[model samples]
Target: MTVANRFLSIDLEKCQGCLSCMMACSLAHEGESNLSRSRIQVFQNPFGRVPDDLKIHYCMQCEEPACMEACPAGVIYADTEKGNVKRIHTEECIGCMACITACPYSAMIWDLENQHPLKCDLCADTPYWNQDRPACVEICPMKAIEVRSEE
Candidate 1:
């Protein structure tokens, strides 16, 4: 099994918790600027810690994805071109919520409108916005997010 050369990386220290990445991701994938549809989420501490309390949450793109195994419909798959990034085949998904339960990090998000689960795919080469990178990384002003490639 070959490891992915390119992967998403985050620097929590630099995150401002503005959620620009979430907005960019939602716009790129869903054609709308809705945070509910975003794959990435920013969690802030209730105590109001400025930079330290912010945490960016998203798929880990596990080497052995539990979501893939737990899916009864076999909609979740690994993207070979992008280093086995776990992705969901939305059309094939049955909205069983198995993937949501299987995700250890609670990264799998439920889409109420689409009746399907959503996870980070590194913005895989889709016709909607076929770029070699993710929208979140591109739109992040603070440069807290990055696409790290093993060269």
Candidate 2:
């Protein structure tokens, strides 16, 4: 498959845990009412503790994805036809946490009630039909996040 250069890049140095990205992301995924169903998970070292600090986590949609390999259900697949967008087939997913464990970045979050893995899809349709970026990139008050060509 041909890899596309499109990606949503986060500049950690510029992020201050404002969580506008999370709010935006959740809203984008789950609509305005439900933030808990959002895909991305933000981590902090607890009270802004040292070493770990704060970071917003989400799928990088890697070229050689470990999460894709780890899933036994084959729920994960690449939209190689659509700019190499990696996506999870919601119907195929069995709520197993295999992909969640496989992710090195700890980007996966388990939806306890729905029993599904949650991660970023990077707003593929919005930017396709309209000239808008992902919601997280749009809502980030710090402007620390960016969506750009990886190349």
Candidate 3:
């Protein structure tokens, strides 16, 4: 299968435990400022610092995606037309949470309101689709997030 040439990269050292990335993601995608609607999440440690202080739940967009393999309805697919991004066809979804559980990175976000799973499509089909980069990358004040490509 064709993995995306462009994918996300994160520099945890530059992260300041800010929720900007999350807010931007939610707003751009769902037209809301809800953190739960955000595809990216910033998890901070209660008893640690720096590296341990953050566990970002942003999709790594793996070369061998477990979520794609686990989808029974075949709703999650690598969209070749959309930069080979792994995307979910919400209309075809069977409301199974297998993809969510299969993601080792915990990046497969479950949309509570929609009763479906949500993953980053590299901003290929978001409300802010015209931008050069994803909302998280563009709105990141610390530049903690970025998009990298094989090319």
- TM per candidate comes to 0.89, 0.83, 0.91
lDDT of each residue in 51-115, candidate 3, tens digit only: 76888887777777999999899888777776667888987889979999999999988898998
Question: Which of the numbered candidates is closest to the native, going by highest lDDT?
Answer: 3
Task: For candidate 1, list the clashing residue pairs, or say none.
Answer: none
| Predicted candidate 1 versus true structure: per-residue lDDT over 49-103, tens digit per residue | 8687887779888777899999999988877776677888899898889999999
Clashes of 2: 1
Query: Highest TM-score: which candidate?
Result: 3
Better of 2 and 3 by TM-score: 3
lDDT of 2 by residue, 1-151 (tens): 4466455678777777766777777667666635566666666677665334976777787878899999999999887655666788877798778998999988778877667888777766543223236887787777877766553
What are the lDDT figures for the candidates, one per model? Answer: 0.82, 0.73, 0.83
TM-score of 3: 0.91
How many residue pairs clash (N, CA or C atoms closer than 3 angstroms) in each of the candidate models, in the order given?
0, 1, 0
Candidates sorted on lDDT, descending: 3, 1, 2
Between candidates 1 and 3, name the one with more favorable lDDT. Answer: 3
Candidate 3, superposed: residue stretches over 4 Å from native: 1-4
Comparison by lDDT, 1 against 2, better one: 1
